[model samples]
Target: MASVLWFRRDLRINDNPLLSEFRQDIVLPVFIFDTQILNKLSKDDKRVSFIFYSVMKLKNDLKAIGLDLAIFYGEPLEVFEKISSICHIDEILACGDNDFYAKSRDEKISQSYKLISFNDAFLLPASYGLKKDGTPYRVFTPFYKSVLPFVEILSQNQYKIKSAKLVDFDYKSIQLESFGFEKADISHIPYIDKPMELLNDFKPYFDMYKDLRDDISKKPYTSGLGIHLRFGTIGIRECIRELILYQKEGIDTSEFIRELIWREFWNMLLIHFPKSEFDNFYAVDIKWENDKDKFHSWCEGKTGVPIIDAAMRELNATGFMHNRLRMIVSSFLTKDLLIDWRWGERYFAMKLLDYEASSNIGSWQWASSTGADGVPYFRVFNPYLQTKKFDKDGVYIKRWVSEYKDIPSGKLYDENYLLMYGDSFYKKPIVVHKVASERFVRAYKDGMIK
Candidate 1:
């Protein structure tokens, strides 16, 4: 009987536990273009394009080993049923996904097949990293401290491919049009062929990451590997192993590793409190203004605040935003605009190429001050001050907001100077920062009291 390797988030050939499990057996590797998820996306979603490219790459690699990837476009259950009808599948092996939809889908699939899943997405399995009472940790500091000591780095597996009984079915790649999506122009997007190449490129900047990560002007200061991690093109353990190697070479990896741990923190939170995906973890009974016009302005990068506008424009054009800007823009949306964080979260879910549900929701809740360990409600990010501090020379602002290219750096942060540009040059600031901050603080305090 042949085994079925069901590829979900884990797309790469190396560091794949599911692929390693059936190294010597007849493994039918399959990737389903899930309609349940795809139906919600636009026709030109870059994330879909990236995924399609990755699956094609995986198919080519399998062909080199005298194997073929079985690609399908439909619901997971229906796709699996078709696979079962075609061959005598012994069991289904896959890397487990912890999102709400995945959990539900896997539960239904398990009822029909012997689905064996592994924790390939995170460094620590969902079961590990717990509190003293065997419950999940809501706070991140304690969770990180507790799990740090128990972290074990695994060596990369080298699988021995063996010929086995081949199924008599056509194994070919599926067309994007067949799944109701068109070819997205992703030429501007940076994609790595191998995970090791990405790690190698980041080596030169690894030491300075702690110092320059917060500087928005230095655009690529942080390792640009979020999409790879989100899609599991690179395994978390493999990344940790490289970090360990870097530490041995006398470079401090604590800050970079902490960022990785933050990803795990979100994963743990989502696994324990799945409701946090859609609802506020710590519910506050405050009425959101939900200004439709304000949201449209923010989405269109017409917030009038240079930094916020730059960040939003960057996200709109590239499907990627700088981390510091993400925090600032999110703060501006929830604090200044007084819009519900869910609206901003939903927009990001649709736009971000590297959007992971757990991290995106976690970050939104944190920015909105509604999560278990979120920032204080009154702590609003002042967009002007943030620009002066991070993008002092206005390089990032000029790069994204072309209208402000000729403006002097000093004048960019000055409201009076910006007034000279008038509405034609840029839209006036939607809400006065100080006034909005006071309003939000007062409302938040009253809600907490109630």
Candidate 2:
């Protein structure tokens, strides 16, 4: 009997549960560039380049073990059907994705083959955590406290690759041009070829993460593991293992562990409440203004507010933005501009290199105050105050928004001051922050579900 090992988002060979799970005499390891997803992305999408790079690496890694990775381009079902005609398929082993498109694709594939999915992308599956009432935990603190033991246990867990004879099918070669995609310039992105280097480099400063993480000027204070984790280039378990090792070495890793668990929290919540992907988790009807012109300004980094413009510009240029900046800009878009969080979420999905659907959706909802464990609507972030606290010297601001380099750091924080003394190239603030925030809070109070 032959088993097909399908590599989807879990692109790594190390600590891969699929490699260890297959017990069939013959194993066909394959990767399909699903046209369904690629059709929606732009031709110059950086993520496609990154995935292509990782898949080639996986192919080489598998070949080192006397196995080859078969490459195909088509719809998944059609690709699998072609595979079945060649090999007597017993089961398809893969790491499952919980997103809407993935769940539907997996369900459809299960009708024809025994599709066995393993939770290798995340530390634990959605079913691992529950309150006393047997429902999922909505709040992060309670969920973290409840699942801490499982994370500890799972961190130490390791996997060994089992052997299987390679199915001698014609291993096809695929290139970026074959998929009609041009190579994206990912020169600015660090650790593309090796994600572990970033983690190892961050180890010495793990203790300072909690204190300096929010400061935008301290760029290296944050770990750039998001894209690696997003692609499963580095397994979640391996990350936690490293974290545990650091803790044993007398370094405080509690803050870093908490951030990792936040990623898990978003993943679990998405699985439990799938509708939260497109709808508000809480039953609140928000009357969003959703001005396209204003959204365009925000997208183009013409928002007049220094912090918001700087963050948006950074994301546009490099496909990355600091975590603190993400929260600030998201809140500004949803609350101050009164745009729908969905609009902001979709925009981020289009632009962010490290975009995870669960985290993006959950975070956008949280910023808009329309999600479980969401910030209260009344707590709107003042962009000026945020700039003062996080980018006090305007170093980060000046790095992204060149027009603001001549303006005083203190003037960048004040909207009125910028209008008075800033460069002519800078646009006027879209709306009065105090007025817009108060309006949103009142509107939220009025429209909330009783």
Candidate 3:
């Protein structure tokens, strides 16, 4: 039986159910850098580069064991047609994907091939638990608690594929450069990749993740493995094992582990409520300002707000931002700028190397107060107050917005931040917090209160 192991978001070879099971059969490891998706991406996209790099590593590892990767680069359906004509591909196995495009794509392929998907991307199985009435849980905490006992946290060393026996294929891969991937300057950006043996370097910091995860200035203390998780360079199961192992050692790492559960919970929501990708999940009547000029400034980090702009610059520059700041910037964009959450959400979806539609969309809606268990419209974040509370020393602010070193003489722009984000250096904020807050309060009250 010739089974094809179709690699999608789950890119690694270790503890990968599909990849591991394939070694025991006459399997052909295949990765289709589906042009349908890639054609939509920018040339210097790190996510595509990361995917190319990881799959190359997989191909090379397989080659070391006399096996090779059969990469396809067209529409998945057409590629399937070509593969199906040459040899009988009895089964196709892939890690489950919960994104809108992925689900529809999988369905298209599944109609043509006998396919099976495993939970390699998410810790919890995509299956939902129901009440006696058999309905999906609406709230995150209860759904999270209900699924806690069923998690299977597998260790990195659990899988031992002795060899990758060659399954010859008459196929070719488009070189990464030809696909428009170039060398990236990763000097300033913080990334944690296990394939490069980054785990030992960060082991000392994992225990402190609980205390420092939300600290705006010290994001390195939290495992910056979002990219790894996004690309499957680090498996969800492997991360869980590390979490559980540390807990047994009496390390209080619940906060970081809880974040992983959040990722899974969002994935669950994506599968059940795919419409959240574009439309509002709860408040359907809400409207967003679609000002291109305001959005451009926000994207370019000229929002006049120090912390929000700093976070935006960081995301624009490094493809990452601290979690604390992500929420602040998200909220500021939605309420303060009165911009559509989908607009900010789509930009994040494009720039974040760690971008997952499920998490990205879920978080944007959560911050906008249009989704489940989010901040009520009345509870808006004041960026100035938030900076004073979380980044008291101005460490993070200084690092990103280097223009603001000294407060301006006399209170010309902002007496508090005349130097760093002075009126001259940054654009004046599109909307004032007090007015915007009142506007949101009234709008939400009028729409949802009654």
Best by TM-score: 2
Against the unseen true structure, what C-alpha lDDT does each candidate score? 0.83, 0.89, 0.74
Question: What are the per-residue Cα lDDT tens digits for candidate 2 across 265-355?
Answer: 9999999999999989998898888899999999999888899998999899889988899999999999999999999999999999999
C-alpha-based local distance difference test score of model 3: 0.74
Q: Give the TM-scores of the predictions, in the order they appear.
A: 0.95, 0.98, 0.90
As for TM-score, the candidate ahead, 1 or 2, is 2
Where does candidate 1 clash, by residue pair? none
Candidate 1, residues 6-33, lDDT tens digits: the string is 8888887776777667643667888888
Candidate 1: stretches off by over 4 Å: 22-24, 154-165, 419-421
Clashes of each: 0, 0, 2
lDDT of 3 by residue, 18-102 (tens): 7566534677789998888988888787777777777887877667666678987789889888887877788888887887788
Q: Output the TM-score of candidate 3.
A: 0.90
By lDDT, the best candidate is 2
Model 3: per-residue Cα lDDT at residue 319: 91
From the highest TM-score down, the ranking of the candidates is 2, 1, 3
Candidate 2 segments exceeding 4 Å error: 421-425
Clashing residue pairs in candidate 2 (N, C-alpha, C atoms within 3 angstroms): none
